[model samples]
Target: MGRILLAVVALLLPAHAQEWRLTRSQSLTQEGTRAWRYTLSPADRAGRELWQKLVLQYQDHLRAGYRVDLGSWRLYFLGGRLRLEPHCPQVNPACFTFGALPVEKGVQDRFLLGLSQLLDQALAQARNTGGNLTLSGLFRVELKPGQAPPYLARPSGWAP
Candidate 1:
């Protein structure tokens, strides 16, 4: 029957092919450096793999657009045994090794572009998994030169 075939196909699909969400984020401006951290829910191997290749190989593309005033920055992510961290000496004092990608100054565009691609991958996975896409709401990041990024301490989402 048609329903039986559909059920069988669903059973063969991967879990990540169903949905992705932004589960957590950590932003820090420590020792004169800034870093924002976020993890995707339902992490997928394919998504991580794509980031490894695209981010690691983005140097040439990034060098073409590098600007000194933008300051140095790095974006990193783990892909299986491989880790991709874009280098930016002008901005980042030293790279952080934790499982995060730092976007140093001047590379905001690339960071956004990269995030969009990753999100697209998540969307596609949802389609493949026979699940509807769900978007995580926007989050605000408060930045200071030498302080931990502020977060909403109360339910109203106000920072004191």
Candidate 2:
């Protein structure tokens, strides 16, 4: 009975278990404006699929102004770029708005263009080699000197 239950539970789990990670974070200048670049990578197959789906649906999401939930992070399309914020639960009484990492419009546009090309290349590579491919996004965050940078939460099961 224990064996059967374990098998059932295992069947319910995702085939590709993966989580997103902060692969890169650094300060940079864009169009003479101070900014920070935050790159999130999906270190495995599951994460790659999730990121790809989000990119594919980006146009529709942007048009509808929908908020996308990625692990503990919330994504908002604002001012012509993607903004990152911490996800707050509706039942949490202490929920409040924290500052977000806002990407510049020009920078966002260029990134998206490059991402499209990368995806196309990945598709070709996947067809040639029966291996999985992954992708990451580099977000250009506008810096407000007086305020603190937004806190990026560690997803469940993530270790430093």
Candidate 3:
């Protein structure tokens, strides 16, 4: 009886938990602007299916007037619609840009603080170069199931 119960419990668990693996990355600079591109892939077939489901759910939430917050970044559906391109292997791999922040006073310092939490050494190098250098390289980051999701709805009363 115990063995049967254990088997049932195991079956109740998901076959593949969501895990996004960084597959490719590249830093680019064009016309004095710097940006980084990353390509994330699932660990296996099950992960791929899970990723698709999450994307659909996220879209539905957005349609319902939910705002997405990634760390300090905030995104809202403008004009009642937000266009997201489909992820295509080798062509377009789910792009997310995080730079070109507004030049308002104190904005750069805050942005750098948030960035430093993610890549401390990179920011250190940039500081050493008198802010002329920017992060440029491919980095590996494994997203486990318990970690933060790709994005989440902003909490009520949240500021900055």
Write down the TM-score for model 2: 0.36
- Which pairs clash in the backbone of model 1? 72-91, 73-104, 74-102, 76-101
Q: Give the per-residue lDDT of model 2 (tens digit) for 1-160.
A: 9677546534532322224343323345565533333344555574466445545554345347775443323556666556555454221112211112244443332233333333333334333432323334323333333433242222122111
Off by over 4 Å in 1: 1-21, 25-37, 40-42, 66-114, 117-160
RMSD of each: 18.3, 16.4, 17.9
Measured against the true structure, the TM-scores of the candidates, in listed sequence, are 0.24, 0.36, 0.31
Winner on lDDT between 1 and 2 is 2
lDDT tens digits by residue: candidate 3, 19-122: 33332333455755333333334446754554344344444555567643322233445554332222211111111222332344233223323332333232
Error (Å) of candidate 3 at residue 40 is 2.8
lDDT scores of the candidates, listed in order: 0.32, 0.38, 0.33
Q: Please, what are the lDDT tens digits per residue for candidate 1 over residues 1-160?
A: 9677546533533332333345433335556533333333324565455445433334333334421111122321222111122244322212222113454432333333334444444334433332222222211222233322111211111111
